[model samples]
Target: MAEVHSRSSHRELRVQAGASDNVTANELFDIEEQRNRLSRMFCFDGMGGALLIEPSFPGCGMIDAGKGDLIYSNALYEIKAGDRLFRSVDVRQLITYSALNYVSKRFQIDSLGLFNPRVGVSATIPVDDLCAEISGKQSSDLFFDIVAAISSGDISR
Candidate 1:
């Protein structure tokens, strides 16, 4: 996978599969650690572009990558989810997000594993309504499009 880039900002964060150590749920239980890691990737991804990785904390504990104790950050990227995932249109949006960011892209009330699930299920739906459903909403629907695709196995990296 290519390294994430961000040019408009000074804080760049790019966590390649082997470039740097991956932060496990056990290691990122604390807010500071999660912030630091996310900040790094944020700066890296949004180097020239303007974007932010806001961690859904306090009450946004629905996407469980590890224990609900661990945190998840919602990323705003300029690229499409398929581009990020490095997959064809056969992949789903949430799955693409998971593959690209190395973070779980959640769906529904259940914590379905995005990276690799024991039982796979389609998780695609209209993003317009979902984007409207969230507070502090940002215009980053590419991820949603990818989710819509991946849920149906139609992703193109």
Candidate 2:
């Protein structure tokens, strides 16, 4: 956390980039706290797996233009920074990216993860386990459905 004072010059270098104005000391402190939490996050630095930051999404070898935040070992992780915790869309977004990776065959994705440093929470689920919860459909089956839809032009990438 940073010290909040009456001085006009705030050293909020890490909180926001490119511009220093319009940011309060409390926000900088909060972001620092969140950053500290992220640093303590589970072994993303080689112990877990090979870490790739903002990797390109080679979708279906045709659908170009999408980038993943991070890939650790076999899991694709999406980092979110917000005050809310209970968002299914965040999970759904990961699933979509996972589907893209599956169809593209660029990387071996075996699991999916969501990490929110602001709330100091992290979770990951195996792809197989997640697919098991989806009524009688494996990850392959579900992901293939997306590919099929994309192939048939029923959906936009």
Candidate 3:
């Protein structure tokens, strides 16, 4: 079981897991606490400012992805609610968000970041580097191919 406290709503959310779970309820609660703390740390003003939390990006023709944890100025942040460092999947997701946000030209993200509040670890990379890394991946070509196929309405190869 985990009790999460929301600062914005001033309410508590309780979450419970099976007793056979590997993670304890206290750990879950701690993770949620860290997430809330991180959100508050970056948010400016009560409404809108430079920081936007959990902003969703509607899918274009190929992909629809969003709900980014935070966006400060030109930087987009993805929060990981765990004590461990950022994993490859976390980086990939942030990079994707950055790339999509940039392509959309609506947000123009300049950088991407992964933050883990539990261990106080954070990695920030420029959008260009992220794009390069993503491009270098072998799967990138396949991903683009899929997008192209979807756009052309020709999935059958």
Q: For this target, which candidate reaches the highest TM-score against the unseen true structure?
A: 2
Per-residue lDDT of model 1, residues 1-157, tens digit only: 1222344434433333433367654433433444454444434433334332322212112332322211112322222222123233333333333333332443222121122111112233233333444323432454444334445544433
User: Per-residue lDDT of 4-105 in model 2, one digit per residue for the tens?
Assistant: 222232123365643578767787788788877655553434354455667677656335558878776678888988787847888777777877888668
Worst 10 residues of 1 by lDDT: 110-119
Clashes of each: 33, 0, 1
What are the Cα lDDT values of the candidates? 0.32, 0.70, 0.62
Worst 10 residues of 2 by lDDT: 1-10
For each candidate, give its TM-score against the true structure: 0.21, 0.75, 0.59
Error of 2 at 141 (Å): 1.2
Better model by lDDT, 2 or 3? 2
- Candidate 1 or 2, higher lDDT? 2
RMSDs, each prediction?
15.4, 8.7, 7.4
- Assess candidate 1 and give its lDDT: 0.32
Q: Estimate the TM-score for candidate 2.
A: 0.75
Scored against the true structure, residue 106 in model 2 reaches a CA lDDT of 78
Instruction: Estimate, for each residue in 66-151, the C-alpha lDDT of model 3 and write its tens digit.
Output: 56776766677887866577788987677565445544555657777887777766778876666567675433453454355545
